[model samples]
Target chain A: MDCLRCAYCNICPIYRIEGWESVSPRGKIQLLDKKLSNRLVKDFYKCTVCGLCEVVCQSKLELTRIWEENRAKLVKSKKYMPAHKKIADAVLLYGNPYAAEQEARVLLNSPSNVLYFAGCMANFKVKNIAECTVKVLKLLGLEFKVAGKSEVCCGSTMLRTGFIDVAEKLFLKNVKNWQKMNVEKIITSCPGCYRTIKSNYPKIAEKKKIDFNFEVVHITQFLERELKKLDLKLGTVTYHDPCHLGRHSKVYEEPRNILKKIGYKIIEMERNRDFSICCGAGGGLRAQFPEISEKITLERILEAESTGAETLVTSCPFCVYQFSKVSRLKVRDVVEEVYSSMREVELKI
Target chain B: MYEFPNVRVEVDPEVCKLYRFDLLKVPKPFSAFIRTPLAVFQPENVKDLLEILKFAKKRNLPLIPRGAATSAYGGVVPLKRSLIVDMNRMKNFEVENGKLIAESGAVWFEIERKINKKGYALRVYPTSALVSTVGGWIAQNGYGIGSLAYGSIAENVEWLEVVDFEGLKKVSGDELKFYVGAYGTTGIIVKACVKLRKNNPLGVEAFETSIDKAVEKIDNAYHAAYKNAEKKIFLLAREDGESNDLGLKAWKERFFPLTGYKSTFSNFSEVIVPIESVVDFLSEVEKISKHYQVNFARGEATILIILQSRNILKALKIIKIAEKYNGRPFGTGIFFKRKDKDFWDFKKKIDPKDLLNPKKLKGNLILNFAGLIAWIA
Candidate 1:
C-alpha cells in the first residue's frame, strides 16, 4: 500500500544481515513492483519479517504488515504461499491452526465464564505450557472445567497467514460458540489468540449481536492482576520479550514484575523492548523462509545466552515453542516460570 | 586560460552549512570547509560568482568554499557551519616568479601548461596537477603521484589569497607556509601563488627496475642530478575479468603468489610508492604483506627525464645499460566505461584530479595535461 524506497537503505537490518541491497525493505518494494508489473519476482520468500526494518524506519511503517497486506491482495489475485494457505485452511476447518487437531485444553470455570483457550502451539507442540497454565490458574482457587476436544481455533494463524476473510469467518464462529457457551472471560496463553479475540471479537459481536462479553486477558496480565493475591515467591528471572506480547501489544512491565515476585532475576538483552530482535517466528515467514527465520531466532538466543541467566523466560506459547527448539538454553513458558517457583500450582478448581 | 566576466554577488554563512551536508551527516560541518572561494567576487572582471554569493545571502544561505571533495576526512565544511564556494570557475592564470600567481578556480593542469610554456618545469603539482584547483590542492596538501619525492600539495604551493566569513586576507609564502596544508581552516582560499622549479635540460627522463632495486638506485640518482629532484617510478598491473573479484589478488600474483586463489573477483589492488624513503621501505612492505596479506608485486617503473638534451643521451644510455635489471616501457592504461560511452562522456567521467585526489582513481574522473617547453643554451 505504501512505498519504502528511500535513501534510508543504509543500516537496514535485512541488508545488514544479508550484506546486500536486494533483500532490504526497499529492495522488497522493488521486487513487489516487479511482481505487480508482470516482470516476475524472484526469491519471494527471502525476508524473515524480523521487524528490524520497522525499527529503522523513520516513517514508522510496518513493512511486514505491508507484505501481509500485499500477500492478501496477491492471494486474491492467486499469488499465494501454498503451504501457508494449507495451514490457514486448517485453522478454518479444525478447531486448531495446525494441520491436525490437538487434544489438550486447560481447566477454566466455564468455556464462557472464564475460558482458558490454549492456542494451537500450547495445545499441541507445547502441551506442557497448557498443563502448567491449568495448574497455575487453578491454584488461585478459580472455578474451572476442561473443554479438551471442543475448543475452536482463535483465527490468529489465519490472520498471520493472510487469510483475514477466512479469519473473520472463523471469528464469527467463535463468537457464536462463546455466546452459546456463555463465556464471561477468556484467557489465552498465546498473544496471537489473546489479541485476535480481544481486537476482533468486539467487531464480530457488534455485527452479530452475540451479546456474550466480559474480559479477554493474556495469561501474563491475569497473573499480574492476581499477583499479590497469589503471593508468587519466584525470585529474579530473566524474561524474553516475546515479539507479539512486548512489541505488538506493549505489554512489557507486568510480566517482568510477575517474574520478579516469583523470585527470579530479570536480566535483559542488548536489544530488548520495542527494539527486541524477533525470535524468528512471525508473519507466516517461518513456513515461507525457514533459514531466514532460523538465523534471526539463533541471534535472539545468542543475545539471551549473553545474559547468563539459568532460565530464559517468555509469555507466548509460540515463543515458548520456538525457544524450546534452541539448544542449551533453559526456555520455559511464563506460566512455567510462575508455576516452577511456586511450591505448588493450584489446580483445585 | 579563459576570461570569466564578473557578476553581482553577496556572501552568506547560513546556506553554506546546508550545502555541505548534502547526502552527508556531520555533527560539525565546519571541518569540511575550505576558505578558497571559487565563486569569485572580483567586483570587476567576472562577477557571476559574486552574484551567486549575493543570491545566497538574499536566500539566507551560507557560503562554502569547496575544492575537490576527496580528502579522507571531511573537508567541505571545515568551519562549524559554512556555505560552499566552489572556485573551479576561475581560469586565467600567470606564472611570474619561481612563484606562480593563479586564480583560485584554475586547476593544476592549466598552471602546468603556462609554466612549461616559459621553459620552466614545476616540481610541484605532481599527481594533482591534472584536475586539482590551486586553492583546493593547497588545502588538501595534495601530492602528485611522486609524493615520496616532492611531498604533498603544501610543499608545492608558495602563497595564497584567502577570503573568509570575517574579511579577505592575503596569505603568502612570506607568511605562515605551513598553513598551505591546513585544508582551508585558515579561510576560504580565493587565489594561490605557487612556486615552480626550473626545467634542467640535462635532467633524467625515464627508468624501470624492481621496486626494491629502483628504491636503492633512485636515491643515488636523485642526489646526482644538478637540479636535484626525485619522483616515484611505478606501473599499474591489470588483468582480465572483474567477475572473479581478482582486482587485488591478480595484481599481487604478478610477482608474489598468494595461497588462496579461489576468490570470485580479482579484487583490483595497486602497488604504492610512498616517499623519498622508498628504498628503506620496500622490504618492510614485503614483510608486512607476508604478515598482513597485502597483494602486490614489486616491479620496475618509468621515471620522467628532466635533464638537458646533452644529458638526455646519457640518461638513455644508463637506462639501456640497466637492462640487466629487468625494465621496459609501460604502455598507457586501458579503461572501459561500464555505461554511457560517448567521446566527451569519457572525459566528463574522469575526475581530472585523480592523482591529486588518489581516492578518485576508482571513480570516473581523471584529469591530464601535457605541453612543450623550449630553452636556448
Candidate 2:
C-alpha cells in the first residue's frame, strides 16, 4: 500500500470535520509507517472508510484496507476502543450488533431460490428499508426467501471495525446457512451487507477453502433490471451514494438507473458517484463517536439540502438511518422510493 | 507543563507522530532527520497564535508554523522537539476592496472558488491549490496555473500579516520577500491581502512547440508547458472554446502530475530553469531519469522528475542534473537554504532566538554531503 502523500485533504470527510491531519488517510498512513502504538488507534477509527481518499489518491493505495488492517491489528492487540469491542461482542453473542433475537430477525421463512438479506441495520435499526425492499420485491413478483434464523450478521460492521477474525466466522456461518437453504442469489438492502457478502465473502471463502456459491446483489442492483418506467414525475430528488454500495462495490449507476426509471429527476450534489461524501454512518463511527459522526452526517445532510431536492434517496439502509437522524429533507432508501412509485402505478392500473 | 487553553494543543505522542513529516516521505536515512514535535497547536485567531508564540518563547521551544503541510521539503518537519502551530484552523477569508483578504491557512481552491463567485479570480494558484493553503503556497512563493499571466505568488500579493515572537505585523514590498519563500523560518504568516483579477471564461488550447517558441507566444496568457512521454512539448494556454481533448485534459489535470503512471507511488522533485533552457534541460534529464514532467510558467520552467524510489538522494540527482542545465531548486525550504542568503539573514533578525523553524534556513553538512554524492552520481 504505497500512499503518495499528495495531501488532497479536501477529499477527506473526517479531516474536514476535525481539521486534524491525524484523521486524514495520508496522516494515518504516515503514523502507521512510524509504527506508533494504540494512542492513535482512535484517530484511525475516526474515518468513515468512505474510500473517497482512494479515488483521488495519486498512489491509488487501498486506503480502506490499510485503515481496516490497522484496526484489526489494534483489536488483536486489545487496544481498540471499547465501543468497537461492544459491537464485536454483540455480533458474536446475538448475530447482530443491535443485540436483537435471531428468531425475531427471521422475518419470513418461505423457501425460495433468492434470499433477501435484510441486514442488521434494515432488520433492527431502520426497519422501513427492509419493509420497502420486501414490498418492492413482492410488487416485482420475485420469489425470495428470508434467511430466517439462519441469517447471521453479514459482518460488514465487524470487518470495518477491525474484527475480521470475528467477521470471518460470521461469513463462514452465513455461507453455510445460505448453502443449506439452497439459495442461488442473495439480495441485500444494506450496502454494508451488500459489499460484505458480495466482495468480502468470496475472499474469505477462498481463504477458508469453503464452497461458497451464492450470487450477491444490492437491492438497487437487483431492482434496477426488474423495475419498469413509471413516468409519474416524482419531482427532483438527489441520490446519496453509500460508501459500501458505490465506491466499495462499484455499484454507482444501478441505483441511479432505478431512480431515473421511477420517473424522478435526479439533481446531483456537488460531490456525487465515486466522489460522494460519506453519510458518516459506516466504519463504526456512528456507534463509537456519535457526536463526530453526527457532525459529518449533518455536513452531508446540508449538502443534500443544498441540492434543493425534495427527497434524498440512497440505496443503503445505514445511509438512510444516518441521514434520517439529522436531514431536514426526506431521507429514503431507493427501495422505498421505487416501492412507493410502483404502488402508485398499481393504484392507477 | 506549558498550556494555552485558548488554543488547541496536542502533546500526545501518537498524534505528534502524524505531524512528523510533510508531503515528502523523507525516506530512510533522511527520515531520521525529521523529529516529531513536542506539541501541536491549532490557533483559531491571532490572539491564540500570540499566546502560542508567547508560550514557545518562554519555554525556548522552536515554533514550526505549518499550513496543510504541503511542502515536499522538510519545511514543516521538526528538526527537534518543537511546538507546531498548525495554521489550518486559522482559515478565514473575504473579498474586500477589490482584493481578497484571507487568513494564511485558507486553502487556495476555497479562496479561488469564493472569489470566482464574487466575479474575481486569483492571479496565481499552485497546482496543489485544491489542498495547499494560501500561506503554504506563499511560503513557497509557488508558481502554477496562472503564474504565466500573473507571475509568482509574491508578485500578486498586496501585503502579508505575519506573526512573530512579539506580535502581528503587516509587511509588504521589500520586507515581503523575506517571508514569501522563507518557509516560515522568519515568522508565521497569519493573513494575506492578495491581488485579484476579474473572473473570465477560461478555456485552453494545446500545441506542440519548442519551449522558446511557446514562451514567445505566451504573452498575458495563463500558460503551462507539458512535455508528454513522447518527448513532445504541448503548450497548453488559456484560450476561448478552442480546446482540443489534449488541451482540456492538460488543463483539467493541471493539479495531478505524472499520476497516469501505473505505479502505486511516484517520487518527484521540482527544479526551475531558464524558460529557453527547459527543452535542453528536460532532454538532458530525460536521457538519465527517463521520467519527467515539465510545468513552464512565469519566466521559468519547473521540471518535476519522477523517481523510481522513495530515496531523497535519488531525487537530489535530478537537482544536480538540473544545475548542469543552469537550473535551481524551486523552493529553498531546508533543502536549498544555501541558495537564499537574504532569507537566512532575515530569519536571524526577525526571529533572533532562532526559535522560529530553526535549522531550516541553515542547511546542514549531512544534507550537503548527500548533495555531493548526488552530484557525483
lDDT of each: 0.51, 0.81
Q: Which one is best on DockQ?
A: 2
Q: For model 2, what TM-score does chain A reach?
A: 0.96
Residue B72 displacement (Å), model 2: 1.4
Top candidate, metric lDDT: 2
Residues B267-356, model 1: lDDT tens digits? 111222323433333343233221112111123222322212222223223223223234321111111112223422432432122111
Interface DockQ of candidate 2: 0.48
Clashes of 2: 0
How far in Å is the alpha carbon of B344 misplaced in model 2? 5.0
Tens-digit lDDT track for model 2 on A1-349? 3665678844587886787777887778777745655646677788878888878777667778888888888788777778888988998899988788887664666668888999888888888878888888887888888976678888888888889889998987888888888889988888888888888888998999988788888788778888777888789999998888888889889989899998999999877888788998888888889989899889888888877999999988888888888888998888888888888898999
Every candidate's CA RMSD: 26.1, 2.8
What is the RMSD, in Å, between candidate 2 and the native fold over all Cα?
A: 2.8
List fnat per candidate, in order.
0.00, 0.62
Number of colliding residue pairs in each model: 116, 0
